[model samples]
Target chain A: MTWGIIGTWRMVHDGLVAASKMLQENKRVGDAIEECVKAVEDYPYYKSVGYGGLPNEEGILEMDAAFMDGDTFEIGGVAGIVDAKNPVSVARALSKQKFNSFRVGEGATKFARLAGFECGNMLTERARRTWELRLDEVKKNNLNPYDGHDTVGVIGLDLSGSMAVATSSSGLFMKKAGRVGDSPLSGSGFYVDSEIGGATATGLGEDLMKGCLSYEIVRLMGEGLSPQAAADKAVYGFHHKLRKRYGKAGAFSLICMNLKGEWGVATNVDFTFSVANESAAPAIYFAKMGQNDTTVIEPITEEWLAAYEKRIKQPIE
Target chain B: MTWGIIGTWRMVHDGLVAASKMLQENKRVGDAIEECVKAVEDYPYYKSVGYGGLPNEEGILEMDAAFMDGDTFEIGGVAGIVDAKNPVSVARALSKQKFNSFRVGEGATKFARLAGFECGNMLTERARRTWELRLDEVKKNNLNPYDGHDTVGVIGLDLSGSMAVATSSSGLFMKKAGRVGDSPLSGSGFYVDSEIGGATATGLGEDLMKGCLSYEIVRLMGEGLSPQAAADKAVYGFHHKLRKRYGKAGAFSLICMNLKGEWGVATNVDFTFSVANESAAPAIYFAKMGQNDTTVIEPITEEWLAAYEKRIKQPIE
Candidate 1:
């Protein structure tokens, strides 16, 4: 049986549902879902995804999130959310509160925090160290730090014929106080259909919003293109036309997991992200800079996976 | 006069020669040349153009500059400059230098200071204020401030039938420590031919270097489109295609002054830039949020211009 799911910010809620169901049945599916959730929970930048997100120029971390269940076409989304421990919960709340659609903001954070999760903090020390070094350079060069740039995205497909896609971001730091990137914009930042595959995007939000590159990639998958091919074509479409009009100032990175259980990722930047398959524990695949000779795939360990799962499933309290 | 100027960073050097000669012979032409130079010198962000450029990620404000003389196909450019008060001088130096180019890095600031100009201290109080505001926002949101994004560009063509393009920037805030943007990359960021008018670009340096959108706009001008139309098309091409593929991200604002002495500028961001014709003084322009309205063009007065020019031209000492 084939299924389909599609969305940008709503996909996280859908993933939670899928995970809940999987937990009631098989350990592997539950484990994978749990790992993903924890990945966002533990990663400092993950605040862009869940409850703790970076604020705009106004010093407010308003956030957006989405999740989708490929098999049911079920979706969840939340926009302009503040105080929500994770935008994912607002998505889930939407799924449960409204029959087919729902939206929430302002009170959502308090609601999620009340539901029992700890709020996230600033970027990790490791990430902070990395940023400080870069900041020093910026200071030396006298450049503005609020210039719009950066975001995060994720996509996954399970062997049981379920597809999921999720995106979360704090948006451009010091933006005009209320700017939103494509991270929460469906079709632009992400899309998934069990009949085809799954894809998630990152880059210049405005242009991405215009191109609908993520959904376009999934549509190409429906046309029978391999995951990689779909991603490549979608990216190509934007590069060829949009860059010309806008100037060479934006990028897109995507991951596609097809119905066949095969996965592919493509990006214009030096690095992107991916975790290992079930049995292939202890490895995570990262696209490194200047290593264009061949693909480099790393490993994730079972121990790490176990800890990650614990981190995710544990109550935020 | 339909000549195509090519090369990496030499176009600016060539442009200065044409501009200098034009300045000496025609009053209107001289005024325009002076305006172009003043634009760089006065704009606080234009450290890469005049003197007092902030260091690169490596604590070195090595600079590169170029000038394009549209009428003569003459170009001038200088690269790896340090402490040089005015890169335009190098463009002037190009006319006398045997190789038609010069590299000033170490002692470049010393050279400028020794030339009786103030050197060092590129960061202004205004820039520091902007940086602080951005840092506060970043800290509040927990974002990484050094994530690479900084460059500025200017292009103009006078009613007198002379066109000039210039770019100034501190390069990427924390790049590889020696990276350069499209600003100094001929045919990419800056391109001009009096027969077709002129163009200047800003955005992801490497991708812009590869795409050559500026020259493409000039080519479009050659194909008989208005300067504005040509610039729009070129920017559109990049926004749609190149941006997504290279994970590149930035906004490009370009202005073209045609042989008919008309000017055109286009951008994808809400607050891109400001423009002033010969009849008007330079001021900042910003687009209203969520609206596709014409940018809010502010006008500067002669008094302001005089003060600005005085401040910018005063010896750096």
Candidate 2:
């Protein structure tokens, strides 16, 4: 069997590297997924996910996260979690709780406190700066079209053919207090069935949730579609149906994997994701709408942006 | 064109009847759904859902609710909402919000306050008595096998072929404070699409979320499975996969409809849901496992339990 890890964007480069090393050392996919998510949760550079991340309109940090064990189909999640350092870990804890598979808000915060999770300010200076800059842009009718930037979804395939997925996010910047998106909801952000495959999504959570994007991809894969085709169809549907309601609220991007360890990605917008297997260094790849070819690899270096620009050739509107 | 409403159990009979009345009066499906959910949220006798219904282990009334407009595919939800008298209405408000589609916890509470909702004690005397009695039973290792009872899911289809679904819950009885279930999550407790129809679910939220139960049923219906057959397959799958990890925590139940106005219900366990159409009074129907035929209607009477007993002929255990 083969093993691999995939995540959204170069921002999670460290997380991808860690997950790759764990797989290289023959760790279980569950452990690898948790490790990757935990690493990303600690990385302050990314404003949309984990500790020290973006805050809501009230300047409060409320996060959402979910974890799924592919073999057992056991899933746990927490939404609008405040004062918790690692929502990903808190989600893992809730997953193992006997009577509850999900928690939210004050209840999530209280549970984390009882579970021995540290409570403190997760806001970093970097996030505050980004929030202020974005707020100014919002006032000028120039909203940031970076809804996809708010999530760090990690999927791992172990050598034993098992899979696991973890998704964590601080959610939309300056969102209404208590606002929740697709990050913590099952089937919307992440879904796994060991018999079929696994899927994780990044985009506007509202769009993803309405389309049930991740689960749709996994279901399509089960019905004999390739992971790439499944993802393409789901993203296409997400964009198609959403435009009929709200005009172009960003596009969904997805990374999908089947039981055979084959991985693919598709997106309605120009986007990049990181992939790593035992054979090589973790690398960045680009996927875009209407692309004929399925997957392409690029070095995880300075040339990455140049290569992505060449691949799409069109400016991001 | 016709209009109808369906909900879990007799406790929601009043709500279903109200929704039917509104539809008969030419109200939109969206408005009818909201009205039904609000009625359930106010009813007091039911221990599993709505205001003054039940409390978590910490004696908190953390509620979850969602509203979906089938034609538009727009969804709004709030989880772990506290001190809001009508979480269903709050969820409706979130559904109409400009940017965010969901909110939870303190944030949900704050939004509800801003939206002109009354914030007060939602607990009542009957609920306290139930909690005390249930707590005693729980201490004796007699857990309430009623996670399914946590939700009041309502689906409405108007004569115009439009559909809408609303789900609300006080959440699992004596659950961890802030615990959330299938009610507020799209594709779990409810999912609707104008072209394909809609589905609403009740049961273990975790199992439903992992299986994407409601969405699966709707998809099966889309693939030409009759509503009954589609619900059967989804319930069967929900039971099959969940049993591999947790033994018999109560199987999921689903109610499905197609654009043609045909409806069906299915479950792994014996279940009875309330239904109301354009004609006649709100009624009760039975659907049991291992039956040759699915969907049997019975008189809506005081002897619902005894009539259900006659239909199943098998003990719940």
Candidate 3:
């Protein structure tokens, strides 16, 4: 039996390690994704998601998340939801319904409450201080406030051959209130078909939504391209086309895993991800755009990991 | 110069005819979409869009709308926004921004107010009575509460050879508060590229979001397929596969117009649409699913138009 899991960013590594064990034991795809994403959401130091995620311009902490069951094509999502400790868990619960699966703002927060999911203030003291400092800097220096848009996107394939995908983010740091990124959007943010494969994205939500790259990659995989080839073709091709047509393209990253337990990744900027499968242990890798529409991927280095750990935990002042 | 415009449902017929005149005049794609969509929003007799539209289970007139610029690939959308007299215009304004193009709920409503676009309560007296009756019937008979989810989706190609797409809807009748549908989603409800073509959809947003059929149709057009072939292949193929995978496929209809002004349509259930182009005047057509995944289309009969006009304005008890 072959089981696999892949997620964007270094933050998801520990969660994937736990979910990886569940997959090996033949747990279903739905639970595997929720457990993995919830771990990222609950962590207090990941500044782009859940507990410690940065706030919008108004200093309010809103979040976006989505869950999709590749087997049944059931999709549920929430955007601009607040005070939900684990937005991914709320998304998973909503996926069971036939209608009203995607909710936003007050509705999404209320669902978390009415359904008896865990709820608490997500804003951390460090996060608020960081937002205040950034707000002051941006105004003083006339700096761009759009930053820290990473979303924890996970793709899981179980021993039963079922696959599922989920994504969660606090959206662009200092974004306008109620802004929704591609993290909660289908096709752009995530797409999976258990019979074919699954793909998820993290990056500039605005530009990512312009090209439904996740859906395109899965479609390419279904047409017989390997996951690597599909990621290369879909991601690089659209990145080039978008620059030509739209005059500029924003940074974005994508990862995919096919039904055979093979996986692939591509990006226009530096990206890190963790993955594990039947043949490999959970490991983190860093990738960057390479020459000729390719991606250069390597094992995460000790120096980079150590630096990241130090930076996230640095003093707020 | 060649020009074209197509929109979902007979409800858009009058609006399309008015916009057809502007398309021939070489107006920009942005204003053309807003003008057409706003007409539908203002017509109080229409019960599924803008003013006079059906409300959610809570009897709130929440609305969803989106606008996309094909040349630059800018997208703006709003979901669960309340009391906006013309959500399409607000979406158009948001598309010009580089960040925070999509907003939801209270934030969306606030954006409309802050931007100084028109605002008013959207629920009509007749719509409120209909909601009351439906609520009573569902409680007494235990019938399905989901119905009347048609969205006004428009695709416009102007004399300048530019294309754009827009959509507006009140979402599913009696949906849970803050429920969102495909109308505001990028690849599901609508997609456009001035270099290739544009497509928009109507019917069940829940089923529609699962397929990303709008992007598929446009991509097929990019591959040199005629609009008719693209629509037929993308819509019918997904419809067939979805039923096999998910056990049932909801009703859906799609309409497309290529850059050259050629157009096509496909659907899984009975549908109606209005189209105009360099070669054809604005006219409504009826379509139905035919044998072997083809769509059978015929000009709308005068009797059918008369019946529709009467049905929409009929009194609600």
Question: Which of the two candidates, 1 or 2, achieves a greater DockQ against the reference?
Answer: 2
Give the alpha carbon lDDT tens digit for every residue of A39-113 in model 2.
888876566787768788667778999999888777889888888888988898788765687988877888889
lDDT of 2 at B89: 83
Q: What DockQ values do the models have?
A: 0.02, 0.67, 0.84
Q: Each candidate: what lDDT?
A: 0.49, 0.78, 0.93
When superposed on Cα atoms, how far off is each prediction in RMSD?
A: 16.5, 4.7, 0.9
**Model 3 TM-score, all chains together:** 0.99
Q: Could you tell me which residue pairs clash in candidate 3?
A: none
| Interface RMSD of every predicted model, in angstroms | 20.8, 1.6, 0.7
lDDT of 3 by residue, A1-317 (tens): 58999999999999999999999999998898899998999899999999999998999999999999899898999999999999998888888888899999998999999999888888999999999999899999999889989999999999999999999999999999889999988999999999999999999999999999999999999999999899999999999989998888999999999998899999999999999999999999999999998899999999999999999999999
Residue B20 alpha-carbon offset, candidate 2, angstroms: 1.7
Among residues 3 or more apart in sequence or in different chains, the pairs in candidate 2 whose N, CA or C atoms overlap within 3 Å are: A52-A122, B2-B159
Q: What tens digits encode model 2's per-residue C-alpha lDDT throughout B144-222?
A: 6344354788888887878888888887777877888898889988998877878998877867787788888888888
Off by over 4 Å in 3: none
Fnat, model by model in order, equals: 0.00, 0.81, 0.74
Evaluate residue B256 in candidate 1 and report its C-alpha lDDT on the 0 to 100 scale.
Answer: 59
lDDT of 3 at A77: 95
In CAPRI terms, where does candidate 2 land? medium
Of 1 and 3, the candidate ahead on lDDT is: 3
Q: What share of the true interface contacts does candidate 1 keep?
A: 0.00
Q: Ten consecutive residues with minimal summed lDDT in candidate 3 chain A?
A: A89-98
User: What DockQ would you assign to candidate 2?
Assistant: 0.67
